[model samples]
Target: DVAFLLLTFFILTTEFKQPDVEDIVTPSSISKSKLTEGDNTMTISVTKDGRYYFSPTNNPSQRVELLEKMGEKYNITFTEQEKTAFQNTQFVGVPVAQLKAFLQLPEDQRKKYKGSIPMDSANTQLVEWVQNNAKINREAKLAVKGDGGASYDKFKVLFEGLRDIEFYKFVLVTTEE
Candidate 1:
């Protein structure tokens, strides 16, 4: 009777949503430290292809979304023609300058952006823009979850970018099973 009652209670309280499956990540055998827990944690995932993912944790149990999801949400897709011209030889990700211009634009305005913003301008503008955005988004944790095959150097760049902007709480994401 008690088990049945508990089952009914759980069924009543449980919520369901589409789950976002993350890539399998094998943790390195380096340091064994106690895990920290708090409301202000950021999640970052790195794809095998060297793509970085910054998953916000504002809503618990919800599918993770990028802070830059705004760019996609607003239909700010970079075309192959543009990306070819925009990318450096590495092709790891968007150039820092381009990232800044994209970050600076208001959500609605981002979709309409056509031309690239110069490197120097993007540097100055992105610093301020990230500072303000991070302040506003402090509650949303910034994370980096990289693929097992991604280069350590690329992860270093991503980490430096977040730290340069004064974002501290980074949580490495991994698949549950």
Candidate 2:
């Protein structure tokens, strides 16, 4: 009876982890401290090629609200169905101009999307996102997971943007060596 119960537990608990939207080989750190799983944590994934993706933890309602708030700020509109889809999405990497269409696509198709949110002078979308997200979720703490090979130049603008917005407290997500 015990053996049968153990087998059932193993079968129920085994699960496959999904692949990340972008590949990030985080730099190793001497300190092995783990980041606590805070309720209002937001993560920014940065790839070696300098792309960015954003995700917030565990709250579907907040996720949908973020989409709606961004739409209001950008003068864009999203249908109810699209907002529902965005709420279920694990992370977002596309630009606002393409977000409506991107959200409309099926999950499989969204995984195929390779675009990143713009971070340049002409389109500082990520900065805008961080600011709005902070306002909406006042306790949200940002965790930036940057690839080891990503350039400092790629990070400088984001740092400056955070500084300008007075968002100085952030975590650098890294691997422990």
Q: Go through the candidates in order and give the C-alpha RMSD of each one to the true structure.
A: 10.9, 2.1
**Looking at model 2, which ten-residue stretch has the lowest summed lDDT?**
14-23
lDDT of 2 by residue, 88-154 (tens): 7877898888899999899888887888888865677887788877877888889998999998988
The number of the candidate with the highest TM-score is 2
State in Å the error of residue 162, model 2: 1.1
Scored by lDDT, model 1 comes in at 0.43
The weakest ten consecutive residues by lDDT in model 1 span: 85-94
Candidate 2 wrongly placed segments (more than 4 Å): 3-7, 10-18
lDDT of each: 0.43, 0.83
